[model samples]
Each structure stands twice: as structure tokens, then as C-alpha cells.
Target: MKLQDQPPLHLTYGLSIHPDETWPELWASIQEKALAVRARVAPGKAFGLGLRLRDAVSREMAEGGNLRRFRQFLDENGLYIFTLNGFPYGRFHGGRVKEQVYAPDWRTEARLDYTRRLADLLAVLLPDGVAGSISTVPGSFKPWIHGASDVERITDQLARAVAHLAGLKEKTGREIHLGLEPEPGCLFETPDELIRFMQEWMWPRGRVRVARELGCSLAAAEQKVRLHLGVCLDTCHVAVCFEDPEEALRQYQAAGLRISKIQLSAALEADAVGRAALARFIEPVYLHQVVADLGGGRLRSWLDLPEALAALGSLPEARAVRVHFHIPLHFEGGGGLRSTTFALRPSFFRALQNGATEHLEIETYSFDALPGGASRDVVESVAGEYRWVLQRLVRAN
Candidate 1:
């Protein structure tokens, strides 16, 4: 079948690359950066936007007729929003984000409120007949959630979010899904953990809750949970955990889970020779969780790059280390530090070929943290990533 005949995968890049937390800054970015990028890469074609709105900005967009105005801007500029990066709730850049990025995780009412607001905004912004996705935190930070009660509390909160989504679908008929994006050192970091959550927590408790709320049978409620709650597969996070993308995707599919959105990104990989070279990646802005593979299937994981670097020499059996760093999609490796690009590309293309999801977002949100990135033009960089992915998709087709 021809590419146009198949279901169209909405290709776009996340707006998080621009460190704008307020509405004015965000609107300026759309006009100055987002529009310019679209003009260069897509020209007259309708460009999709993977919007990243913090809690404050989300509230701002929903009020004062901002949503209507923004929709008008999208129509005039040939743009539309298909997905949102709801993972980060507060300021993502210009500060030390560290483990705090996962604060107000699925355990709290605040997370639920924030996500509900995002869904409300997305429902208004999404064009007719197009489904939308909002990628959120993977429960809470693993270390913080101690025991059975913690798990139950977090799961209950998440169920509330899922129930809210079901209500939105019933009310708006837009079918917006919440994608729990898994990352290293967080709850449900790997595919297996995510699957287990679905079977143990989500399916059991969520089905009953949804059934009661929607007044449907258990089977129908189960189906609703499957449709609304899904995974946002971040290529960089999967690669850093040394997961085979094809196998992971297969596992998610087998579990009746939907792939909400594919976050197209690359991670930093290093062997012993290149181990010392990764020191340059030690930045203060975000937490760079590093997973070191020891022989005999043992993996040593650290909370941050500094911890990993400090113990690099002690782990003599360490063969390779993958850091949670979002690098440009087009660049493979540099400065003796390799990227998991090779592993990511084939798997991403495989998913594309199989129609894994409708949304494909290039999410290299760490451009400013990259070496010599301060001088780089954000608009051109975003446009370049879009062009690179577009070319790859065409070739894959």
C-alpha cells in the first residue's frame, strides 16, 4: 500500500525545546520558533504540534479566550495540536530539575488535577476526527513509594485520571488518552513493570472504578481502561535500559496496551574506552540516570550521572553504560560518546511500518544542555530534526 493510503502518523516535535513556562513566552515561541520551523520543513502541509504546557500555562491557555485565539493561530499558520508533554508539571529548565521532576506524581490529587486541565485544553485544541494524547509521569519516583499502601494510593489516583479521561470521551467524543511515560529510576521504569501494573493494579481496581462511573459492565470497563490508559514509548529511555524496541513493543501489544505516542530521541552510550569521555554530560539542569551493565546479567543503576561517574572505576565488570540524555535524532555519536541511535532507528521504523501509534514526536528537549548548544539556533535545530524524521519515514515507506 502507498504511504498516503495507510493511516497517517502525525509527525511533530515537542515545544519543550523552547524553555517557555508562561503563555506569553509560549505564544511568542509559536510565532517566532514553531511557525518558522513549520515553514521550513513542511511549507504548505498542515503541521502537527506536540505541545508542552506547564500547569500554570495550561490554566492560562484555558482562560481569557486564549484557547480560541490559539486555535485561530493554528488555522492561520497551518498547525494543529495532536499530543501534549504533560510529564513535567513545573519549570523544566533554567534550574536544577533532578528527581524533583517527578514530583506530584500520580499519587497526588495535584497530578490528577493538572492532567485533567491538560485534557480539557487538548479537547478544545484538537481538530475534529483526530485523537489526542497526553504523556504523564510513571506513577511516582520508585524510592518514594515504599509499601503496599503507597502502591494502592498511587494506583487509585491514576484510576481517577483514567476515569476522568473516560468522561472526556463520553462528553466530547474526542478520545483523548493518557500516556504514562516510563523512565529509568522511576516507578514502572521498564516494560515488564508497566505490564505488571496494568495486570495487577490498573485492570483490577481501574475496571471496577470505571465500571461504576460509566455505568458499564466489567468487560466494557476493561476495554475503556485499555483505550484510555497507554504507554508513551520514549526511545531514549528504552535504549538506556538496554531494551530491545521490537520485543518491548511486542510485549505491550500482547498485553492489550496501546502505544500512545513514540518519543523519538537518542541516549548516550559508552564503553570502557569512552567511559571517561561521558563526564562532559554531567550537567546540573536535569537528572541523568545511568544504567551500567555488568556481566552475568547484572545491571548497576545510579540516580544521577555524578553517582555513576564516581563509581565508574569501582565496577570493574562494567561493559557498557547508557545515560538518560536526550540527544539529537540525526546525530549518531560524538566526542567519543556514542548514541543509541542505531538501536532506536530500526525499532522506530519497525513501529512506523507496523502502525504502532498515530503520533510520532521528535523530543530532543535537552538541546541547550548539549555541548556548544547555547549558540545554536533553536528554530533551525527543530526544523532539522523534523526534516530528518520525515526523510526516514519516506525511505521506510
Candidate 2:
């Protein structure tokens, strides 16, 4: 069978690796990194980019003539955008992004506005007859929500966002879905948490609210909610949470939740004996949430690598520690650290075989933070990641 005859999947590398907050800087990064990577990896094929736009850049691009120029640039470069990384609303690098990454969570109008803008931008940028996806933060950081009222507010905000997406679809005829990404230490971190949020809060109340807003029946409204709101399965995050990707994908499918995009990435895994070696990853720029799988199906979680290291004495003995570090997808074993790359293959293959998701984005956003990553050629590393993932997908088919 020919490669094109196999399952159709859109493969791209997330542009979040480039920390360009403005349009000029962003375009430069794309020219320097994205184009270079595409040239080396994809060559003649029309490459897709998982664009990551900050709030400022989004606004600027939305201005008169800017987005058009960008589209022209993509056309000239043989590049197209099918997915966006809207998870971070602001600065993601060169500073302490830690927990502040989830600042304007789904509970606020700001989050809604930002996402709506993204949808609008995507509607224009998305190629004709191609669907687009925007991956966002999962509600809020778990620690920030005080009680049921906070959760209620989040659901209300999400309902509004869904209504906005429905309107976008009505206006542009482009079906862009919001993928609520579940990360470690976030509100809906675990698979169970995500499932519960959709079933309990989103479905029960969201359906009615959406029904009222869209002037549709409850069943139709529920369908809209399901179509608009879905999961962005980040392999690094899921692996860090000790989730068996196959089982998690099955659970999402069984629950009727769409996997909008699968972020092809890897997490750092270290056994108890190799725990000391993980200290190198305890940086201050990003929050490296760690989960240690304790016996009897219990897991001990920490907010960051430091907290995990500090509580090492108090926590019970664990099998392995999965750190929420976006390592290079191409390289698996190095520096006494093993990658969760192994988990990605089975999950990715199964998802593709089962028609789970069409968008597959290589999202190694922490390239700057990785060891030796600073000195390495960013284009080469990203291109290598694209090559690695594409090879796997081809082999799987």
C-alpha cells in the first residue's frame, strides 16, 4: 500500500520552541527555524506548522494586512497552519513561566477573548476544507480554585467559549475546536479528572447553557459542546501522569470526547536509583511537575522538580518518576534519563488506526531548557523530531 493510501494525519512541529512574542520576531523565527526545519525534513512537500501565537502577536496579526502577509509568506514557503498552541497566553520563555503559565485560565473572560481571537485568526489562516485546532490550558491550576463556585465559574466560562466557537463556525464555515490540554498540576491533570469535568460539569450544565445560547435542542447543544470542546493529548503530560496512552485514548473515545490533536512529545523517566540524576532538570524557568507511581495504584505528585526532590524522604518508595519535561522526541536515552518516547508509538499507532485524531504535532517546547539545547542548532533538532515522528507513523501504517 502507498503512504498516501494509509490513514490521513496532519503532522507538524509546534512553533512554541521559538520564543518570539512579536510578529517581526515570530516571522524571523519562522524564517530561520521553521523554514529551515521544513527544508531539511519535508523538502518538496507542503509542510504544516503548529503556530504558537502570544496574545500580542495574535492582536498584531489580526490587524489590517498583517495576516494577509503571513498567509502570503506561508504560500511562498510551502507552509500551512492547521493547529495552534494557545496554551500559553503570554511570555513562555526567558523568564519564570512556572505556574503563571495558567494565569488567565478558562474561568476568565480574558481566556475566552484570547481563544476567540485565535479561532478567528485560524479561520482565515486555515486552508480551504481543512479543519483547525487550538490547544488551551485545562481550566486553571488546581491549587488556585478554591471550591465548587470556582469550578462553576470555569464551566460557565467554557460554555461561553463553546458558544463563541459555534458562532465562528456559523460565520466562516470552518470547524475549529478548542482542545483543553491537561497538564500535570493543572485543574484537569489526570485522565479521570478530564473525563469527570466533561461528563459532570461540561455536559450536564454546559449543554443546557449552550442550548440556550445557540437556540438549539439539548442533544444538539451537547453535540456542539462535544464538537467544540475536546482534549489535546500531550504525550509528555500524559506520560508524566503515568497514564497508559492506549488506555487513556480508549477512555476518551469511550466517553465520546474528541482527541483534537495529539502533541507528539516525550517525558523524562527516571527510576529510584537514577533519581539523583534528575536534579539537572530542576530549572526555575518552567514548572516540572513530577509524579511517582506508588504501589497499590496510588501516585505521589509534586508541583515542581524541587518540591519532589525536597519531599523525597517523606514519600514512599516509588517505581519510577515521570517528570513533565519535553525532551527531544528523537533521542530516548541520555544523561541517565529515559524518555517516555516508547509510550508514544503504541498510543499514536492505536489512535491513528482507530481514527482518534487527525492532527499530530511535535511539541518539544522545552528545547531551550534541555541540556545542550541552547548551543545546538534549533532547526536541526526540530527537523530531526519531524523526521523521527514521520518515520514512526509511516512504519506503523
Candidate 3:
């Protein structure tokens, strides 16, 4: 399994990890793992980097003269900055290694402030030699204002963030697009809401026909906005919303929206008895519904993960999708643990074997919060899990 043998479309696979462990130690392990992945499948296409939302060290590295070190690290390791995941944005102050930084109080002002800092940071972090770039999430800004006026306010704030990112792109001499992700409980939850907001509030002057009809643009009606705004496209978010993924993706395409990033996660759907039983152990967020072959007697994890992906691959102009994998964890004795709690099923492996996809990312970031989750062993555990996933994918391919 070398790079040349893989499908032409399967080049952008990758993963994400917190920068809590020492960078030298983490980089060493990551480089070795990525190189092994490259050697095994699609030799030269090293898994890109997903700078998690809570990596203050990486964020700091994105600033000051240290950015040279960071850039050198990417070059040396064959990785690129994909997206800065704004995690733990809610008010949960305690739980895992990330909870402390997960500022749910992240209002629009706080997010704007973070974005400003991030833009400046990227000015140094991602210049030439970088593959692609993305902006941080927009802080909730205003949760109470959910109707038209709230949408309008969010639009203005988002526009400002995009313009700022555009300026960062100009300074860096690279096109770093900022994607506004709609979380499950956030203001911009539905795809329709995000699309509408982008049209009226973000780019009122209108690039699409829908925008032109609304007469929305305020400052520069004739100016053509590049529409750097788009959706993050998380599978879990879509699944939780109970939207038909294939249909949702089509609507997004029809609206002329770009899927800036794709979060690939599995939603565990249980059968009648199992659903009722599992409901007793975990909350609904951790539980979802799925179909089962009464004859086969197996569980259905992803209602349409494969179907959604196959549909995506069929689209000629769809945005590049980045896989975001989340491993399950159990809390015991006031701690956490991450192992083979959830592994990629055979059906998904079969989908990959049939060449039904492009990218694969290892995203088990909450590992540090698992029961007995000591930071000392997290990277090793996560790196091992990464190796396991790669081996399975290669074997299936």
C-alpha cells in the first residue's frame, strides 16, 4: 500500500491531536506515523494536520518568531494546517484536559477577539509553502437573539471576521478561507439557516441569484464578494439534526455553498430494545436511531455515513471532504479512558475498499478526558489508535 496505488482522489487524508504533550515528542511520533501511513498507502500524500481548538501552544507557535519553527515543523513532517477546530466553546468548566479552555462564554465579542488574534497568528504561521488554510469558529456572539435581528447581527459579525481573514490571506499571500460551522445547539444549526445568513447578513450585495433578489448588501452593492463563507459540514451535527445527509448536501450545493470542512464521525443508532436500553446509560446526544436487518441481527452505527460519502464522491464540483473521527470514552473513578471503544465497522471498510472515498483523518481528541486520562499516555494511546485505523483502511483498500 503505497501512494501511487491509491485512487487519484485519495490524497488529502489526515488527523488531529492536542498539543498538550511536548511538540518535539508529539512531532516525532506523528512524523513516524504519517510516514508509515504514506509508505503503506499513497506514499507521498501525508495525512494533513487539524490544529485542534484547544492547542494554545500551537496557537502560540502561530505567532512571534516561533512561527518559523512551526513552519519548519510542517515541512519536516509533511503536514499542513487544515482547520482550527474551536472546541469546548460552551460553559463546561470542568471535565477533561480541554474543559478549562472550553470557554462557553465565547460570545461574539470573545470569538471576534480570538479571530483577530488568530488572523495575526496565521500572518506568521501560514505564509508560502502552506497547503491550505481555514479560520476559527465565530463565538456564539448572541445566543438570545435567534430570529431575524439576531441573524442580522451574526451576519455582520461573520462578515467582519471574513474580511479580516481575507486581509490575513492578503498579508500571507495565500488564500485562507474561513468556514462558519453550525453546531447542534448553536445559533447557526440548520444548513438553511447558515445559507440564509451567508446570503443576507454576510454578503448582502449578493453573488448568488437569491442574494440579488433580496437586495441585502449594504456597504458595497456592486462589489462581488468572493463568498469565503461556507459550512463546516459535520456528519454528527447533520445526523443529530435528523436531516437526510444526501439531501442536505445537495441543497448546500444548489445554494452555491462550499463545504469548507467535513467532520467525519459515526452516530450510533440502536435497535428497538437496544435503543431503549442504551437510553438508560447515555443521553440522547450520545445516542441516535438507525436501521437494522432483523434477519442479520447487527447494529447500525451510521444511518447513511457511507451513502452520504458515495453521494459526495459522485458530485463533480463538491468541496474536498476531511474526515473527522471521534473515539468513544468511558468515565470511571472520576477519570477517562480511550481505546477500542468504537472501531470503524466492516461496512465502512468495504466502502473504502471499493474506492468510494478520498480523505481519512484520525480525530480522537477527547482522549485526554476519558476515565484515568493522564496526559502522559494520551499521545501514545491515540497514536496507537491511529496506526490501527490506518492498517484497517489499507487492508480494506
Candidate 4:
């Protein structure tokens, strides 16, 4: 499966973990922060970077020989990039990002242009014969997709991206693919929804569009689209929706979908007793979708965490609640609240060890905003997560 890109299962850190600053300043921040994390985590080995870039930074990096300079930097250090978090179009933190993070969603030409720029940058940055992956938003927020035309527009835009990627591969030998990352409140949050969208919209119409655009046969276009487009299986997001990771991976594979990358994160969980403690997490930066277990194999979902807390009084009797907050993988209970790390069972690690995907990115957003988390060091925290995950992976093997 071309897993030799960044060997040893290709584990990397999401620069988004330090989400407070980006662009201009972030350009320098990345060089320093990446070196810092590498020194603490894997001082003696080559470090893998799961980079994040927004439209503005991407534009800057594309010009002025910046791409070449960054490549030189990586080559000088024992560092390499295998994956990118392209989900956030701009400004992921330090303000009210809430649902606006999904803006300029897959339907807009802006999104398409931004993605192509990233591909160009990655084409130069990737190592020889190493495949690259970019994880993007899941079409759009679920509420934003109103009708068939919206779906059509999103599909058409994505097809254009696939065609661009195909052309890039033709010119450059780098094989970079785009992955649609499904979040709890996004368009393809559930397995059935993702399957239906791919089978109905992408497979039938999107491929035809790609074929026409690329001036290739339907079969050739289909192969290119499937090869370049797939799902970014996020562990915390699936857990937030009360879905099993191993089973979810099985469903995706059974549906003939590729696991572009696996984002390693842990969600927050608490029962009714701890509902009040959850108030501490009420922030304006990110959307925390909540899923309530209504018992008898039933689940009720809220688009945001605050909404779930507000409706908890009127909702049916519940057993536990899982929040979309991407807590640190090593996080445990505190004042009645706990982590969903348990969801990442031994089977999950086993599946990963068996080459479910070549890209493994440890991802958690704005965890420093949590209580007591602010006091912890970002490098140490991320290093701790790497240690924890690597231990489990070794045990599973």
C-alpha cells in the first residue's frame, strides 16, 4: 500500500494542536514548533509532520520561493511531511469559529482553488515516491446542504479537484489525494449518509463530470477520482457519534472506500451527574456537537454542545453523553467527566497495525483551553499522546 513514505506506520503531529496563532507569524512558528516537538518526541529519528494550512498562508507559501525554502529546512532537519489538515479554510482558533469553519465549503470555487494550491505545495514538499494526503471538510455543515443542487455543486467542485490532482500526478510523480473529513455536525456525519453520498452523488455523477473535464474515459476517470478522493476517519469524531472505530473502519472498507488517514483523538464523556461540570468547556472557538444516549439502543443528537446542555432538561432519560470536544488521547476523568479513549480498543490498534492506512496523525484541537490543560506544555502533551498511542500499537502487534 506504499506505506514506506514515512516509515514505521507514518505517525505525525497536527500543528493545529497549537491553534492560537497562524499565518505570517505562523510561518516562523511552524519551523520552531515542529523542531521543538521533534526534539522532545523523536530526537534520534526522522520526524513526520501533519501540517495545517489556510488559504492566506497557502497563497504565501506558493510564492517567493517559500516552498523551496521549506523543503530545504525539512531536508536539513530530520523531518518530513506526509499529511495535511485542509479541513479549516481559515482562522481555526483564537476567535468564534463555531460553524463558520465550514464556510466556503466544498461548493465554492475558492475551496477548489485553495485545495489545488495545497496540492502544488505538497507536490514539492513530499519525499521521493511518498504519497501525500490532504484531509478536508465533509462537503459542508449538514444544515447548509439544502437540496440536490447543493449536493450537485459540491460533487462537481470536488470532481474538479480530483481532475487537478490527476493532472498534477501526470506532471509530477507525487501521488497526493484529497480526503473529506466527516465531523459530528457535518454533511456526511453518519456512515449511511457518507455511503449514500459517495454511491449516489460521487460515483454516478461526480465521476462523469471528472471524465468530461479530464478528457478521459469513464473507467479512467473513476479510477482517478476514487484514488484521489476518500474519507479521513477521525477516531474522536466517530466516538462522539457513538460509533465503534473498528466497525466503522470495516463499513468504510466494505463500501469500497479508502481510509485516507486516521486522525487520533479522544472525545469527552460524562453522565448527567457531570453535566454541570461540562459548563467549563463552554467556549466560543469551536463547535462541540453532543450525542445523548437515550437508552434502549436509541441516540439523540444535538448540533452543538451548548444546545445539548440546554435541552438536557426536556430530553428523554439518558445514560451518558459524549461531546465532540477533541480532548487529549491521554486524558482521564476529572470531577466526574471522563474521556472516550476507551473507545480506541485493542482491536482498533490492531487494525491500524495491519496497515488500514499509511497516514496516522495524532490530532486534538484547542485542548489547551480546557481547565488545567493551560498549565501543561504543548510539546510534552503531544509527546505524551505519541507515547501512549505507540505503546498500544506495539502491544497490539
Provide TM-scores for the models: 0.96, 0.96, 0.60, 0.96
- Assess candidate 2 and give its TM-score to the true structure: 0.96
For 24-64, candidate 1 gives per-residue lDDT tens digits of 98888788888888788877878788888999999888888
Q: In candidate 1, where is summed lDDT lowest over 10 consecutive residues? A: 1-10
lDDT of 3 by residue, 104-161 (tens): 3233576655655555655555434442334344335233455665555555555555
What are the Cα lDDT values of the candidates? 0.86, 0.86, 0.45, 0.85
- Per-residue lDDT of 158-249 in model 2, one digit per residue for the tens? 88888988988999899999999999889998789999999999998998888888899999999999999999988889899989777888
Residue 145 in model 1: shift from native, Å? 0.7
Per-residue lDDT, model 3, residue 58, is: 48
Worst 10 residues of 4 by lDDT: 1-10
In candidate 1, how many Å is residue 105 off?
0.9
What value does the lDDT take at residue 111 in candidate 4? 90
Error of 1 at 306 (Å): 0.6
Model 4 residue runs over 4 Å out of place are 1-8, 19-24
lDDT computed for candidate 3: 0.45
